[model samples]
Target: MVLPGVYAPQEDTELLAGALSDEPLPPGAAVLDVGTGTGALALEAARRGGRVTAVDVSWRAVCAARLNATRAGLPLRVRRGNLFDPVRGESFDLILTNPPYVPAPDGTRPRGPARSWDAGHDGRLVLDRICREGPELLRPGGVLLVVQSALSDPDRTLGLLRTAGLKAAVIRRRRIDFGPVLRGREHWLRHRGLLSATDDKEELVVVRAELPV
Candidate 1:
C-alpha cells in the first residue's frame, strides 16, 4: 500500500518494471532499487530471485516499501536515505531508479510531496547525481536502468553514463499525457521553451547503462 506522502507507482514505474522483467537475472543476483516508493520494482526483483534492497529518502516511503514487501511475501530490505547513502560499499548486479525529473521554476531543492517530482530548473538535480555516482556502486557487468522525461534531456544522461565508462542508451520510450503537476506547469514550461505551445504530452524514456566486466 502507498502511504501518505509516498509516491505511488505510475507509468514510469511500470516502464521500469517491464525492462527489469526482460533483463536476465542471475540466480540470487544482488539488486538495488533507488528511490523505491511502494517497493513495486523491488518486489519484482525479489520475485525473480534477486536479493533486492530498496532505498528512499522518505521515511514514509521506506515504511510503505517494507509493508508492501511483507504483504507480498517477498524478501526485500528497505532503507531510508538519500540515493546510494544507505548502500555505500555495496555493489549491485543491477540498479534501478525512477527519480524526480520534472523541471520546476524554482531553483531551490524541493520538499514535502514535491520532492517526488519537482526537480530543479533543468530537472537534472537528482538525475546528475545518479549518473555520476551510480556507476561506482555497480559490480562488474552490472546494469543501471533509469527512467526520465524527454524534457529533462535524456542525451545528457546518456553522455554522463558513457563518460563514467558505461555503455548507455535509451532502451524504452513511451509518450504519456501530462499529469496534474505537468498540466499545471504547462504554461511555464512553454514559456521556458521546454515544451511546445500545443504539446500536452511528454515522452518518458528508460536509459540502460551497463558496465563492462
Candidate 2:
C-alpha cells in the first residue's frame, strides 16, 4: 500500500493491524488516523467496523490513502492538512498516529516525503504537537495509540500527555536499531537521562493512553 511520495509504511505500522493484541475494535467507533501515509491504521480500523478520517499533511499521502480506501472498497474520509488542523472541532473514539519522530540537526528540517515517518529536531516536532493536542481531539474514554522509536523521548511524550490531562500508559515496546541520525540524538536524550537501558538497546515503544470517561 505504498503511496505517492511515501516509500512505504514501516513494519511497525503494519503491526498495528493487530491493534495491540489482535483484538477486534469495538463496533461503531469513530477513528482518526494522523499522518496516514499508507493508511494502514485507518484502513485497518475500517475493516474492524469503525468509521475513519484519515489525514496526512502530504498531499500525495492523502491521495494515496483515498485510493487505497477506494481500492479496498472501504469508506474512509481522507484529507490533507498538517497535524490536527484539518480535523479541528472533531473528536474521535480512537486516534492513532505514526508521526515523524526523527531528530534532525538544529535549524534543519529533514528532507523526505516519508512525511509520516520523519520526526523533526529532537524527535519532538510532530510528536510534541500531537501530544499537546490529543486531549482536545479525543472523546472521553477514547484511546490514543502511538508507535515510535526509542530515538524519540518516550518519557517526555508521557509527560506531555499527562500534562494535557490524560492518563498515559506504555502498553507495548520493542527494540529497533537507531538510524545514524537517531543514534546521535540518543546521546543527548541519554545524557538528559531520558533513554533507558531497562527497555533494552535500541528499544522502541508503542504507547496507549486513555482519556478519562
Maximum-lDDT candidate: 1
Give lDDT for model 1: 0.95
Model 1, 1-213: lDDT tens per residue?
989999999999999999998899997999999999999999999999999999999999999999999999989999999999998999999999999999999979999999999889999999999999999999999999999999999999999999999999999999998999999989999999999878879999999999999
Question: How does residue 129 of candidate 1 score in lDDT?
Answer: 99
Q: Give residue 76's error in model 1 in angstroms.
A: 0.6
On residues 1-213, what C-alpha lDDT tens digit does candidate 2 reach at each position? Answer: 675577476556765555544544688888999888878788888988898999887777888888889899999999889889998999999999888776555526655563455566567878888898877999989888887766678888888898888888777776665655456666665665656655336666777877999
Candidate 1 lDDT for residue 64? 96
Q: After superposition, how far is residue 154 of candidate 2 from its true place, in Å?
A: 0.4
Clashing pairs in 1: none
lDDT of the structure predicted as candidate 2: 0.76
Off by over 4 Å in 2: 20-24, 178-201
lDDT of 2 at 212: 93
Q: Which stretches of candidate 1 lie over 4 Å from their true place?
A: none
The model with the greatest TM-score is: 1
